[model samples]
Target chain A: MRSTCLLLCASSSASGGGMEALRVFAAAVIVVGFGLLATTAVFSRLQRNRFVAALIAGGLPAVATGWAIGPGGLNVVDDSTVLLLRPLLVACLGWVGVIVGMQLRASLLATVPPLLWRWALTDSVLSAAIAGTGAAAVLSWWFLPGSFGIETALVPTTLVACAAMGWSPETRSMRVVLTPSTQQMAMLIQGASGIAAAVAVAVLGVAAQLIRLQPDGTPVLDLRTAVVDLALTAATAAALGVAARHLLGLARRKRGALLVVFLGTVAAAAGIAVDLGFSPLLLPLLCGVMIANFGRERLASFELFIMRAEHVVALLLGLLAGVLLTPRIGLPGTGLVVAILAARILVKPVLARRTLGPVTHGDANRSPLRFAPLRQSQLSYVLAVSVVLAYDAPLTRTVLTAIVFAGAASDAVPLILGFRRHREVAQERRSVAGAEA
Target chain B: MGERTDMRLLVLIARSEAAFDPLVTGLLDVGISGATVVESRGLAAVLRQDLPIFAGLAAFLPQTTGSRVVISLCGADRLEALRAYVAELPPGDRPLAIALPVDSFFGLEPTS
Candidate 1:
């Protein structure tokens, strides 16, 4: 590991050495081994205790490690190398999108009751609206200044809001949800809500940004530009979906071909979105869904195959996002971070109870549905990182810092509650059973 | 050779999905590596796990994702060691484990 790091650090001896590539390849092999160990831990201990499980899935350590190596910290990985890794980061998001998209198996989703779907939709809409409004307000205040026009603040506003809207179900696998909802109804609620939350994030990613000035100081971005971005993303993804359909056979049979197809298609979809000034995260996600549903039967194997790769990419994405978190955040940046995290934390449960009040009763009324929105996962992480990478401003720093903190805390809360709730129940039972006797 | 000898099948029914991987890994570390894990939910799983908690909600459902069964066919000589190792694991967290003799076996041997 030391030798590999040294080789990686000594890159560009007058620039462009095959040895540098070789060292990176070597480093990847080591990283993959570590990723495998981490993935094994994730799966092995997944159902252990929800709190410990959360600790296992937590990105706090990865972020800390990233900080240690980051330019702001140890400087082991500097800005230029981080720049070189941008394509890989985008590819990581693409893979995350694919993992999410493949979960939209129509046959599976069809089984979820309409009542739960209504609840899920309501939960997502409420959370997004509340979080978005709060984010927009924050950016309008001390966050965005002369860099963005007051009239055009919607661009950064919606982007910040989009970061807070995603919630993860943290399924043990696609085969089962990790939540204690063993019943069909409960499982359906969990699944539908998770899917609904992801869709909400996707929609937020591509929503209107109104008018903004170009870096050249020429004014650009209008309703027309938004329309064009929407058109280009949809058209590009649709075309790629068709292209992927033909390549699916070769990809399924040949391992090398599989990697090329995914990397190529995702790269193209993401690249096209960037060129068109659209959210690059949405297109590959669409493409992934399209591919998975396009030939539904053969997709399970492909999904599982990509899952092995997904583990590695997930760690890297978390690490890179962590690396971007700097030590410096002025008072304004701190305020913006606090505004987003606090609003999300404050809004989720209150809104959940209000929306779910009509649908449930008894213990179910006291349900977990409201609690989940507080937690954020890869969907939230990828979106926040995408915005930071795209906008490149002080506001982005605030969003990233806040998200890393919020995501870890939010994910821990509900999971820890799962175990704590059980322990409390057992304690209550111990006394109550004797009292009943 | 070891291939010619009859073996015992190590059968473990773990209460939790969390225990499955560790059991497999433990066996593998002791050189009893080849194992098959299957998703199974028996009456005990429904009653003891699902019914008591999920209760009325799961009672009507056709099947729930419950209990996991892990099986590995091992050489007869290794059964005692496997049993000893499993015995060492904490009781509550451990699975319901047993070993059954394989009278006759067929098909291709697992390629390690």
Candidate 2:
């Protein structure tokens, strides 16, 4: 491990610094490994109980654990340590992107109820619009005119909007739900969340390419460059996907061998994407989409393997987010959070009533899925962290902090509402039974 | 030894993967050394596969079925013993077993 670390440092001689820096890097890797292991052990123990398992599935607890040990709290995961783990974090992000992308099996999706797609599209557009406009206003007012260009603000705002477009897909923790009554709604939420996550990641990846920061942190808009980069990345991702699929076949359906193929593919794609100023989330996502849509039967077990690791990857990213978060939710940050919350709380339900109502046969008050939209999508964290990585700015950290807070808060909304719904449901059942008696 | 009419094809559908071990042990103890175990899934597993990754943990839950089907050819005495063994197992761990009469069979080595 030391030799490999040294080699990695040696290969990048320009920024390798010296012995002390290498020591810090090694320490960071050890710290992060131990942190993840300890966190996993605790989480695994807690998840044995179905109820606790559901709660942990939402991902805030992992984030909180990360935050607790992070520099802001305990100084265990300091900034320098996080900087050293950049490549690993990028790979983790790619892992998540692949999971999201793998859900895009066209054949499978075609069989889904049309209501899911409609809900996903509606939520994506409205959430993005609400988040983008509100964030733009806050950001515009927050930044001085001469400090930065509109493109700088535009990129983060767009990414934030993209982050706001989905809800948590976790249904196991929702114990209050009567499965028979809410099964369709739960499935709809899960399916739409996947679609919304795909849209958000893709849009965030594309929007990220539109702006490039110079050595001095000046944001430059280069449309031709963005388009060319995007096209190249997409082509490269497709090639990688084909190669990965072929390699997976050669793996002889062994889980260990399949895992190696996945890791190598994600690492290569993420490295290339990061090197080319593209969102590392896009390439592996495209690769996953390719893998899912083609040669699917052969790779079914592989898909299962990836899905099995999804929560672990998600929690890892959440932990990284916690480590990377600066908790500097300034005035603009506060406003942005409020904007996102208002949109999720107010706009989302009304939109659901207007669009999903007809098909669902119930509006917000009548629908079992009423609170489903309130929980922020876990993919939002992935996007926010990607932005933090792309731009190491105070503003980006604030965005991440706001997202974390919003996600946690949004998660609570569903629990409270679901409990009330559960009680009301029991009461109604008893009343009906009494009348029948 | 009894005639071929005494043979029975026993099919045990273990409700979970964990149930196969004791079942196989019991089958072996009942003098049935040959059996085929095939991995199987319940309808819930199929539906769970359609869920997004967030709820994919359903695949790992203890309650979720990872069923296996065990098929074997045995004599009436061994089949009864296997059935008795299965009946002795805890209700939750016991697999559903069915015995079909076998008219003819081959590939058996007669003991010297």
Candidate closest to the true structure, highest TM-score: 2
Output the number of the lDDT-best candidate: 2
**Native-vs-model 2 lDDT?**
0.70
Model 1, docking class: incorrect
Judge candidate 2 at residue A45 and give its lDDT: 57
After superposition of all CA atoms, the RMSD between model 2 and the true structure is: 8.5
Off by over 4 Å in 1: A1-34, A41-49, A146-152, A171-189, A208-219, A253-257, A296-298, A351-370, A425-437, B1-101, B104-112
Per-residue lDDT for A259-325 in model 1, tens only?
A: 7887888777776665555666677767766775676454433444465554466567677777678
Q: Worst 10-residue stretch by lDDT in candidate 2 chain B? A: B55-64
TM-score of each: 0.68, 0.76
Worst 10 residues of 2 chain A by lDDT: A1-10
Best by DockQ: 2
Instruction: Give the clashing residue pairs of candidate 1, or none.
Output: none
What's model 2's lDDT at A360? 53
